[model samples]
Target: MRKRNTLRQGFACPERSTMTVHDAVHARRTIRKFTREAVPEALVKAWIDGARLSPCSANQQPLKYKLLMGDAAAPLLPFLRWAVMIAPQLEPKPEELPPAFVVIAVDTAIRAAGAEIDVGIAAQTIALLAEEQGVASALLSLRSREVPVRDALHLPEQMMPALAIALGHSAMEAEAVPYEDTHKYRLDEDGKLLVPKRSLSEVLL
Candidate 1:
């Protein structure tokens, strides 16, 4: 299972197959600033449906998604910003802030490894679907180990929380661009995507 959740994983959209899931992957980014135009609840619902179709281990189907939209989402911003402060630079600019979020949590005790995997896969699904719907998203990792999100959301005790994906109507005049200089990108001598790779190849294999 992939340790980190990403907007990639080549999950194909077999039904339409029009945009090529790869386009979504390469185009997807953690959109922060968002337009003031609120996202319609209908669009959010579609994203959830898209996530529900994600493949699960043994089809355990252990994942669950609860959406917080409209007025129901206001209280979350304060604590959400607190968790986000750990990476202050990553904060969404005013233009990038999403109005609401589709909080993805899972009951891992039932499915174990599959629960984690399902949560991640579902996240990407929503991300892609958000782009398809002309909305934008940002994958906000839940922090503060002491605070249980399930309790905050009034979810069941068994449901272990995983991710909080903020979604909103967006106006992205700026394109997702690679760094102008490789120095900022942290690449390898071979121009591979490298991030502090080990001197001894890290794996000791």
Candidate 2:
């Protein structure tokens, strides 16, 4: 009798990959203190590619991305607010400024109802992808800076700036700390960035 061919049954084992999606997810931290080291353009493009494939509301994909670097990133710096929770101590210094930025704009011509959700997913996707590339990112809402950002970027009236993500090599460290009565994050005396997260029990209900 002929033996059954296991190869034809598609049972081949795959080689081990460097890092899993879960690794990238869990390792991701909001990095505000970035090194002066410039982020390669190719890495930024890869992050944007990942963001573009993120799940969208009704497949409308209403998000538009604008990549800024060098001089392009400087004009938008004043518009960005960092470490508002800790303000003076946690605010990034001149040398720690991010070397690149991506402005996620919402196209008003598309359905606007779910644009917020779309932007949220896309922004996180970009951040996570950046982590995989050994780059760091800070996702900024750009609320008060929206108008100025629009003017500086020369965004069309039809395009509304939803968020800005700062990216570069990180110069500082951030760690998740246990949650307490107040869920606000603060810096330690040593100046390490600390983030407070809700306890599992507090979130499950």
Q: Which candidate leads the pack in lDDT?
A: 2
**Residue-wise lDDT of candidate 2 within 79-100, one digit each (tens)?**
7777778777766888878889
Task: Give each model a TM-score.
Answer: 0.68, 0.86
Computed on alpha carbons, the lDDT of every model, listed in order, comes to: 0.63, 0.77
**Which pairs, if any, clash in model 2?**
none
lDDT, candidate 1, at 88: 55
lDDT tens digits, residues 1-205, model 1?
A: 1121123234332234355567777656556556778766655776788888888788778887878875676545554642233245445565556777887766666665546677788998999887765566877776631236677777788776677888876544334433334323232445232222233344568
Clashes of each: 8, 0
Least accurate 10 contiguous residues by lDDT in model 2: 1-10
Query: How accurate locally is residue 92 in candidate 2, as Cα lDDT from 0 to 100?
Result: 81
Which residue runs of candidate 1 sit more than 4 Å off their true CA positions? Answer: 1-18, 78-90, 93-96, 112-114, 145-147, 171-205
Poorly placed runs, candidate 2 (over 4 Å): 1-17
